[model samples]
Target: MSNEDVDSRRRRFLTITTGLGVVGTGFAVAPFALSMAPSERAKAIGAPVEVDISKIKPGAMRTEEWRGKPVWILNRTPDMLKTLPQMDKRLVDPKSEVDTQQPAYATNETRSIKPEILVLVGLCTHLNCSPLAKLKRGGSEGMEGDWLGGFFCPCHGSKFDLAGRVFKNVPAPTNMVVPPHTYLSDSRILIGVDKNKKSKKSKAKA
Candidate 1:
């Protein structure tokens, strides 16, 4: 690697170390080595991540990093959940039949393993831009009717609802992608891990 590249990687390492409170702890090499895969492109798509989500309050959103990209965890209100199905006719891919955006297990009313909590990659499908959270009713006025809540991409005027479903005539062609994930408990979620692995691990223990 070039000197600049080395410096950048070092900086990232320092940042992660500080963020994770890894100081004075014994290092585990296996998981770190496993995370570095055979291809960068594959690694970019999915990286295992464990997150403690007990702090987020109702009607709030929290951002987490996975595969060097931002992942959003939103705590939706009861009213927000009610707005999703009502928005079907107004959204481009309302049914969430678009396979590219999320896994089959997550293709549901809430678009998640658990209702009232939505997990999605925060990048806009228009041109990979990060969309700003606009969680208020009647978004922008021009869209017409009660807007409920959602995200708005600044790059190309793409708009997504609370379910992350892109609006018609927006720059984004589909909803924001939902990375593979599983809920370890009511308060803990493991992103980048799927249900099949959980089954395998369960079988091994049995």
Candidate 2:
């Protein structure tokens, strides 16, 4: 072939090879970039979880999952409400003084927005173990004679009152976490979002 023709052929080959290389790199990076982004299921898992509290009759408890952790909702009877103050002397943080353990609105005697409904993350603060719900008073759930119905962590013998307050001298250093939450209505509660913030957002949307 003539020199000019050969040069032209070589240039064409180079262009085609460079184009393929770029295309190959794009294909290789696309999948990786997509994988790095979160999936729909993952987004759903991290999103706020709503719970219906209407059917959770008084003295009964309901369990739900939020961000892969168990969230408990307890409809406290009048008697259960009375038990809180009685055990204050034996609690590590009876008033939910640890700010990180719950939202500002929940920093109360019951650690809840409503006095009769208690919400808490079910994991033991000492170790992440799920505690057994010993909701009945006395030694019915392998508790001591004075046990006033709460949670007992079998992993390390930690005791928590019905309001999720860590008992004095327990492995858990603080009260169980009460996740940010808001009541959408008398029967519905939305977890993972603060009540005040949700109200602000509703106003903004309007």
Candidate 3:
């Protein structure tokens, strides 16, 4: 082949290869960029949720899902707090008898760090269904009126008061469950393992 012809062919080949190289680089870089960014599941799993309990107001309950279960963080008003103690007679386990229903630290009135802030798992003891937040006092829902506030499950119509106590005559045999947790600061709650319990478990495993 002639030198000029051969030289022309080489130049054309180099140009095509350069273009293909750039295209391949663009494809590879796009995927790498995606890898560097956080996925939605990753963000949800480990993300620290910030909730402003300040605006929950009086007699109002706010519910958010954490770790696949409904985590209700309620701000009980003065009236609601006053009403909590009076509903015992109407409950199936007025004394919070079902010990496993709540964390050890949350066995008191309101079931929380502060009397005003209540946190609980909203599932009913019957068939693992979620309960509805009842903001009123009475109506033979099986709970007392002085009832103040709480949750009612529609699946089996199981009822739980502000303290996670199960009302009498409900399908749920026990009180609503409270997950293992602790207050991170004043308002932040980490709801999975109890720090103390986890240490004990790890020691036993080791």
Q: Distance (Å) between predicted and true CA of 29, model 3? A: 25
lDDT for model 3, on a 0 to 1 scale? 0.68
Q: Tens digit of lDDT per residue, candidate 3, span 137-184?
A: 775556555556778888877778877788898789987777676667
Off-target runs (Cα >4 Å) in candidate 2 are: 1-37, 197-206
TM-score of 2: 0.76
lDDT of 2: 0.82
RMSD of each: 6.3, 14.6, 14.2
With a 3 Å backbone cut-off (N, CA, C), the pairs that clash in candidate 3 are 144-147
TM-score result, candidate 3: 0.65
lDDT of each: 0.77, 0.82, 0.68
Backbone clashes for every candidate come to: 0, 0, 1
Best by TM-score: 2
Q: Which candidate is the best by lDDT?
A: 2
The TM-score values for the models, in the order shown, are: 0.73, 0.76, 0.65
